[model samples]
Target: MDEHQGTAMKKKSSHASAITMNKDLEHWVSSEEQADISKVIQERLKDKKPKGKCDICRVHPAKSICIKCGNSVCSSCYFTMVGLCQNCLSKDTIEKWKNKKTDWKKILEVDWVD
Candidate 1:
């Protein structure tokens, strides 16, 4: 077969693109309505508090905060030695320092900038 026959060129049409806005999902919001929504959301966020439940177990009341990620956790889900939540540290690392204490405050002191 000839090269031109093997590799055919696809001609782009002048028609509109396939992407189109769905009218059913679109909504027209006025400036006044938008401002009211923004104000209400801000007020609700200001009054909202932590759920007070363990992020890991979601059953027990959170008694401590993980120093690494600031996630609220119960005694069972928190690694007190490393000052990190079960979600932050690996299982192997948790077992390695099961009995040892870590200076997690040093993490806060470290300069992150390159």
Candidate 2:
């Protein structure tokens, strides 16, 4: 009935509303519809291709695209650790041939040509 009591009631109502909202979010995220939506998103992303030639060499067809700079690069020009093209990686690294230091030839079973 007092001003203090009204403020306390408002706080309690806000807390209750927050709890209800969290429950709704949990239900929405865990539902079958959410799974279907995720699947659809992944499928759409898989079909998407990068635009233009390789940003690094600008010669080869871009097979891998950088998620950060959105630069399209060929497999030979792409650096997996930094997720960037050869030119971008060179700028970030202290050494230009830092990628060559790693024994990728021995590690990977597949043959990768430059």
Best by TM-score: 1
For 1-114, candidate 1 gives per-residue lDDT tens digits of 776754543122212222234443366778999799768655654544335889899999987776656677898898776666888998887787676676656768865554
Q: Model 1 lDDT vs. the true structure? A: 0.69
TM-score (all chains, Cα) for each model = 0.39, 0.38
Each model's lDDT: 0.69, 0.72
**For model 1, what is the alpha-carbon lDDT of residue 2?**
72
- Model 1: which residue pairs collide? none
Model 2 residue 57 CA deviation in Å: 1.2
lDDT for each residue of candidate 2 in 1-114, tens digit (9 for 90 to 100): 999999999999999999999888786455788688658655655655766777778888888766556677888788776666666664646355654577676789767788
Worst 10 residues of 2 by lDDT: 90-99
